[model samples]
Target: MSTTYFISDHHFGHKNIIDFENRPFSDVDEMTSNMIAKWNAVVRKEDKIFHLGDFSFLNKERTQEIVSQLNGYKILILGNHDRGRPRTWWLEAGFDEVSEYPLIYMNFFFLSHEPMYMNKQMPYLNVHGHIHGQKYEGRHYYNVSVEQLDYTPVSFEQIRDSVVVDEEQA
Candidate 1:
């Protein structure tokens, strides 16, 4: 069966990210290579990956180069840093689609680049990134930031298992 995955804040080729996010990498090259390797290890070309955003800080050409090396059909939910780029730019860079704002997936989940307020009263679960290493707590919130997910794509199965379904919804 084909699988789906979610991840965000890759910031590929951004040297400052190492210092800004306290990422465990010696340099930008190492971080980028390691992430690509880890991503390819779990994501097959036929699989789908929902990248919550901040995908890359490099120029279009370099970004495309990096994205081309990865496996999976990528979908991007534009983040804070991704705002300046055009939708077509991301599509050309290997993303299957680019969403400018939050997306509703499978009628049960809200996908966003930044974590949004969510409670049991809400109808859908919120899955997001952009917080980096911040701790997220709540029944309706699921963070797929690279920092939280060990710098790899997280399977939808794993996320589904963690979702807290309300009696009314279930």
Candidate 2:
């Protein structure tokens, strides 16, 4: 069975990101390798992944190479850093879909590269990335950045289950 996963801000091949983001990796290669490992560990070959963006800071060839190694059918929600590239560039890099704005998933979850407003009154929860390790105070917003999720792709089921658990506790 295919599962849906969410992740963002791998920033592969971006050496400065290590220091800028205070990433745990000693170097870009280590960060890239380990992130690929973690992704493959949970994402099956047939699984689908919504990559919330800022995916890489490399030439087209290198970026495509990195995307090819991962185990999932990838979709991209463009982030600020992803702005300069053409849509074709991302598609050529193996993304099944690319959206310039937020997408509503399953009619109950809002998916975006940047965190958007949400509350219990809203019809759907907001799932986003882009703030790195930061998190919003509201329970209706979920950040799936690699920094927030331990450099791994989080399954939608996991998010849904956690939300259910949180609701029960409240």
* Candidate 2 off by > 4 Å: none
What are the Cα lDDT values of the candidates?
0.89, 0.89
Tens digit of lDDT per residue, candidate 1, span 1-170?
78999999999878898999899999998999999999999999999999999999999899999999989888999999999989999999888889998998888989999988876588677889988998576667788889998998999888887664533355
Q: Which lDDT tens digits does candidate 2 get at residues 1-170?
A: 89999998898898998898899999999999999999999999899999998998898999999999999888999988998998899999878889888898988889998988775587567889999989887668889989899998999999999888877887
Residue 151, candidate 1: Cα error in Å is: 0.6
Model 1 poorest 10 in a row by lDDT: 161-170
How much is 21 displaced in model 1, in angstroms? 1.6
Candidate 2 lDDT for residue 67: 90
TM-score quality measure for candidate 2: 0.96
